[model samples]
Target: MAARFSLTFDSVDAPVLGAFWKTALGYVDELPPAPSATRAEGLAQFDLPEDDLPEHGVWLCDPDGVGPHLSILNVPEPKTAKNRLHIDVRVPGHGSPDERWARIRAESDRLVRAGASIVDEVDGQHVVMADPEGNEFCVAATSA
Candidate 1:
């Protein structure tokens, strides 16, 4: 049997992180409406405990709907330090380092406006930025 896996982040602001990932990965948020009275009444026949779910949570699937979902959880505490594991994004094509840097900078600016912090810039070749929750990710220049 294949193993099942999902990435979960203990986030102080789960909704924010969820939104970021959704934008970055082009994943859709899954939102189901409240159970209908008939459905709830039927479930109650089984004496199942009431499902008290959070009003705000995020669930995303890949474009193919194959495997692995990313779940961002809302916790009481924020991320305090650098992540031991981080994600690196490449620009998707080949070019001179300078050209790549310029592109990276432009993209970084967009992210910055979206609540990301520009932690550092390395000669436009790469940038280190933190999400709203302070999880760091790197955007690097690349050749097409």
Candidate 2:
């Protein structure tokens, strides 16, 4: 009962945000239960589609099983305001300030390419960004 619960996101198109976050956060889409597999086991396994197809509901899980799983739920309304609780993508700091900023910017660029838009950047501190759904999150540089 003490284990962390999955983070749920309310979205207009659940699968789109799910897929975006999957790539943005280096997560994988969770698969449904196999014919013979239990529910828990199914949640542990993921499917990689071999062909192009439109997805519906999407749930993302960390491949390393370190972070909480992210599930995007379809909602009728669109995002109108900022999120009260947001995730911070922490990139580990390695060397000097410039080096750390480089690392942070590199990650920021990658996420932007993956469908995130940069909201702003605070010098060498962090890069604030929003997901495809306009949900706000931060790419923070972690201390060494």
Candidate 3:
């Protein structure tokens, strides 16, 4: 069996980053465990110190339950360098290369409206983009 794990990102503003990712990935906030209505309430159940509680973090999960959960944690420092690891938003479509590339551009444009900025475009292959906080990711279609 394969082990499962979640992705964690350090951010100056966890909630903002989380919101952007939620929209970009079609994800929703991970609900707190049963009996706790809110995440804050859930944290309260743990009896952790106010300072220790990750009040600045946000948790998100795939709505279809396939992808790993994403955790954005607030940190003191700002992002200083390009990410060693990143995400790729795959856009699948049918028809000719032009059609597929058009779909990719449409998706990239939507992301730009949602606070992502286009960094580079590699012809019909992919579009490199950065999130609001400067984390890099790509939007591309699979090669056949």
Residues 30-130 of candidate 2: C-alpha lDDT, one tens digit per residue = 65546625434453355634331224357678999889988787766788988999999989757888988898899999998888999999988899999
Q: Write the per-residue lDDT of candidate 3 for residues 1-144, one digit (tens) a residue.
A: 999999999988888889899999999999987898988887787866567555699999999999999999887788999999999999976788898899899999999999999999997789999999999999998666
lDDT of 3 at 91: 91
Q: Compute the lDDT of residue 57 as modeled in candidate 3.
A: 90
Residue pairs clashing, model 1: 93-143, 93-144, 94-143, 94-144, 95-143, 101-124
The per-residue C-alpha lDDT of model 2 at residue 88 equals: 94
Candidate No. with top TM-score: 3
- Of models 1 and 2, which has the larger lDDT? 2
Q: Candidate 1 — worst ten consecutive residues by lDDT sum?
A: 36-45
Give all TM-scores, in the order shown: 0.71, 0.80, 0.89
Candidate 2 global TM-score: 0.80
**lDDT (CA) per prediction:** 0.69, 0.80, 0.90
Candidate 1, 64-119: lDDT as tens digits: 67646776766666577789977665666666766777778877887787778889
Alpha-carbon shift of residue 76 in model 3 (angstroms): 0.4
